[model samples]
Target: MYRHSATPRPYTTVVLAMSTDGKIADVARSPARFSSKSDRTHLETQIALADGVLFGASTLRAYGTTLGISNPQLLQLRQQGGVPPQPVQIVCSGSANLDPQMRFFRQQVPRWLLTTTAGATSWQKEQALGVGSFERILVADTSTGGIDWNNAFQQFFQLGVGRLAILGGGELVAALLAADLIDEFWLTVCPLILGGRTAPTPVEGEGFLSTLARSLELLSVQTIEQEVFLHYRLQRS
Candidate 1:
């Protein structure tokens, strides 16, 4: 088992999926699509549990995600229970893409854009954020040139985020894996064969905790129907 931090709060994660062949996308040819209702439900469940939800802006544009609970009654109950109406939806992009008209921006809950430069987004090029105080956080170091997970976490800590659920496109996931930042990996491998000559896997690069294979150890495995959900923990030597 990996030794837990005293606060037990490294970057928490929920890598929900309906991927077959252990790949996030069907092939490198196109965008990945979820094939199971159960998998989608699992993602929604995780979102409800988090204090904040984060991902890359490219994933945001690709997935067209609007972070909100679907069940109105449940959402109301959670709000009544002091759980907050919605988790802070966070995005990491070097160039800010402020699409104020997007449903996510329309929502009352604020969003955080962790950016490296003030270069405008395509959306922002057409129209700017006319309202709301959405955070535009500029990282101290541009040497990495992208969102630094450790630095981002320090920002999260300041925002009072205790737990986080992450939805990632491959690149961001790879970054988290390399940084050894992710707390848990929840993968729902679907029953489809996607043979792509060149495609991305669950994680990539020489980063994350990969050097120490023992850093992430399998904790549980289960197959509900045709889908497999693999859960792993960061193991310490």
Candidate 2:
């Protein structure tokens, strides 16, 4: 298990589903059902376990996700954990070109916008007041074009989030991986193969060199029909 530092912060977990060839979406960047029903259920279970659920701009635009946990049993589990009935919904957009009218913002949950300096300006003008009832958090300046991952996590800690779930677009996951902030990874591998040269993978960015690559320790695995679910804990060392 990756241990937390002296200061309290959320356990960052990335939950994603891809095909056997490891593509989140098809070549056209269009959304499609690649994972099984079981995998979808598992995703809800993970969401129920989190204090906050995060998504990147591209994912949001592609799926128009509501970020809601639909199962009543899952809601009960959250209640038992002493977490809120609905986990906070968070969206990170470096460019802040999000549409306020998107279905995600219409959902009833504490929504938060984590954006960089450039994003703040775009958001203020494009998104009207009371449009989406989200808390705008501006991360301090950093080299990353997007909000600094380290600073965002610190802010999440200050907000009392103890477990955060990431359902991402590859670039966002890459940023977290580069910062070494993600603790656990849950990957659902569907049986199909999507062999598109332009298809997005689980991680995309200025990737680490072979010698600098991070490692993971397999935690558990579960199979349902043709789909396989994998759990791995990041080796913090």
Candidate 3:
């Protein structure tokens, strides 16, 4: 596993709502609306706690709008904590081939992008044309055309993001997991079965061998109605 220096990155937590069969989205990969309103509130609560929320391009494509804290109490709490009303919403993409007209760009929240040099160049051109919305574009790419997880997180820390929430579309979570950068998870298992080989899960990439699979220590579990809310901490060796 790749380890970072003594500089502390954000305390990263992944928040996801999956079906009973461990699928985050169906085979069609449309916006998953199977979770209940309670689950939405749970997600907003998690988002409210973070300094920034990170998600991938595919996720943004699936749901053109990012979740923001709308609960009045949650907004009040943020004010009391001396932070902005909404946390920064960061989109991570290698190619930065995002729609300029997505509803996400119009949302009243701080927006940022994490991408490669090539991606930044393209998006910067769009910015010059007055069609870009990202307040900051961070470029941290590896030689193999992949993101440098350690470098990205270090930049996140430098931006004063002490707490980060990962809202995933599987591949992003898998990359962070492989880097051993994720700290905890808030998983909500809804009462449904999205059983399809092509369906997306909370973690997706090349499957891990049993010997190399990461472990999680269950922190807590709660049954609300038919949904199961599970909290876990990644077990580091």
Best by TM-score: 3
lDDT of 1 at 104: 61
lDDT tens per residue, model 3, 1-237: 123447678999999999999999999998999999989999999999999999999999989989999999999999999999999999999899999889999999999999999999888888888875999999999999878988999999889898999999799999999887999999999999999999999999997999898999999999999999999998876
Query: Which ranges in model 2 have alpha carbons more than 4 Å from their true place?
Result: 1-7, 143-145
What residue pairs are clashing in model 3?
A: none
Model 2 pairs in collision: none
Q: Each prediction's Cα lDDT score?
A: 0.67, 0.83, 0.92
Candidate 1 off by > 4 Å: 1-11, 28-31, 72-77, 97-103, 107-109, 119-140, 206-215
Better of 1 and 3 by TM-score: 3
Best lDDT goes to which candidate? 3
lDDT of 1: 0.67
Across 141-205, the per-residue lDDT of candidate 2 in tens digits comes to 57857476777887887787778999988999998888778999999999988888899999988
| Span of 10 residues, lowest total lDDT, candidate 3 | 1-10
Q: In model 2, how large is the Cα lDDT of residue 70?
A: 76
Clashes of each: 8, 0, 0
